[model samples]
Target: MSLLNSLKWKAELQAITDTVDEYDRPKEVRTKVRDIYFVEIGITAEEKYLSQQAKTNVVRRIKCRWDNTISEKTNGLLIDGVEFNITRIYVLPEVREMELSLAYVD
Candidate 1:
């Protein structure tokens, strides 16, 4: 994965957290529960044409896509269409796990 991809993923994760936080309850989710994928935000190279120098210019923008996928299986709870896997379920202090899912993109 490239740096851009990593940063984009982090942003997307934060977005998910924000969305979940707005829920009425701790809506348990699942990952890849349905025929869905993730969204990757970016400016398509073909969207714009620029000179060599212009192409080298860096721009800050936010974009997203729903095409990323995790073709793996593990012990987790499926909610709606998201996956809340037991990434790290502890017993002492608290349970630590992560919910994953393919972005539901139409």
Candidate 2:
């Protein structure tokens, strides 16, 4: 139960798709679904460094409601038209809050 005003940016949680390339190799593609939303974005000092070391280019943490339509294995977030790969999902103790660790996709 945090204040809602901090959640400023609107985003979309996208589902992952597996498709074959011209070389016949499997590639994971993310497609935006109908489930778009507003979410809170934050960045911690520790998290920033850890992501940098991991070479994931993760610049922020995103907080949003839990959606049955998405999961860490099958979805990512699109915020401000920037694509981010979801590296982890942390569900708060109350199960009402979901925090995602996002890695920028270039």
Name the top TM-score candidate: 2
TM-score of each: 0.17, 0.75
Pick by lDDT: which candidate is best?
2
lDDT tens per residue, model 2, 1-106: 4536655667877888889999999888887786554565678888888878878767778777765556767888887788888877777756566788988776
lDDT of 1: 0.29
lDDT of 1 by residue, 1-106 (tens): 4333443232212111212447566543433333222223343354323312343322222222322332223333333433332222212222222223222221
Q: Output the worst ten-in-a-row residue range by lDDT, candidate 2.
A: 1-10
Query: In candidate 2, which residue pairs get closer than 3 Å at backbone N, Cα or C atoms, i.e. clash?
Result: none
Among all windows of 10 consecutive residues in model 1, the one with the lowest summed lDDT is: 10-19
